[model samples]
Target: MRGNFITLEGGEGAGKSTQAGLLAAWLREQGTEVVETREPGGTPGADAIRALLLEDDVPLTATAEAHLFAAARADHVENLIRPALAEGKWVICDRFIDSTLAYQGAAGKMGVDTVRAINASAIGDTWPDLTLLLRTDGDTGTRRAIARDGAEIDRFTNREFAFHRAVAEAFDEFAATEPDRFAVIDGRNDIETVAQEIRSIVTERLK
Candidate 1:
């Protein structure tokens, strides 16, 4: 049997990384082998691309950025995510296809369908079985992200409020379109409360 694939998504400071860790831990405690990873990463080739996309100062047009993301995702899904799922290990990813749709596609003024088509070639049919969208207000998420990263903010995080707001709206639209595949979680709650809600959802849905 193939294991489940779960992806967590949200704008900056939405606590995706934190929730991903907690969710992976909980799943492991339930006797499931888990693999926790992040987008534009999880494999060496993808990690190199991640550096260029997030950490480096490279300038890229929206189309170029979208292509780079798709390239990294191709490597990640093929080399790491696919093998782990084949081995029956539950995969918990901090971010995935939805992030690209939200960030570069909608917020960056590129069409979501266009970006989706580009990634379709990269990931094939390996979509996540469930996606947790940790929804948060744009202002609040921006503040939290700034505080969390301090001087190390990434390229996306450095964008203006309008861009972040667009990203949030894009996420909401995606969730609305695919309610079966996405669980919209209010991210303003405390950590434990959010984690428990996620655990409950996973149990009810995946089991």
Candidate 2:
């Protein structure tokens, strides 16, 4: 049987990382082989790409950034993610293709279809079996993100609130389009609540 792929996606400060970790632990407890990874750095080569992509000093065009992210994902999938999944392990990703659509395309105003085409060329057309989109108000998201990593904000994060708001709105629209593949969880709650929700979703979906 093919491994189940569960991806968590959302705007900054949505608590996706914590939830992903919690889900991984729970899956392991259930005797599932879980491989937890994040976009842009799931493998050695990809981690190098991730460094360049996340640096605040470097100025890159949206297209250039998208290209690098896609490249990293291609290498990550080919070298690390795919093999682990083929072994029937649960693949838990902190962020996946939906992030590209939200950050670089929809919120960046680059056009979602274009980003989809680029991503499809990299990671194939199949969607993840489940995508948890952590939903939080943009205002709250901004404050949380700033608190979470605001001390070292990047060009992307330092952009106007309108940008992050756009990203959140885009996520909503994206989830609406593919209700089956997407699940929206309220993220304003505490970490334990978010983790419990994640644990429940994974248990229900993959159990």
By TM-score, the best candidate is 1
**RMSD vs true structure, all candidates:** 1.1, 1.5
Off by over 4 Å in 2: 149-151
lDDT of 1 by residue, 72-117 (tens): 9999999999999999999999999999999989999899999999
Give model 2's TM-score versus the native structure: 0.95
Full-model lDDT for every candidate: 0.93, 0.85
TM-score of 1: 0.97
Instruction: Kindly list the per-residue Cα lDDT of model 2 for residues 64-134, writing each as its tens digit.
Output: 88888899999988887788888888899999888988889988778999888888868884458999999
Q: In candidate 2, where is summed lDDT lowest over 10 consecutive residues?
A: 148-157
Q: Which pairs clash in the backbone of model 2?
A: none
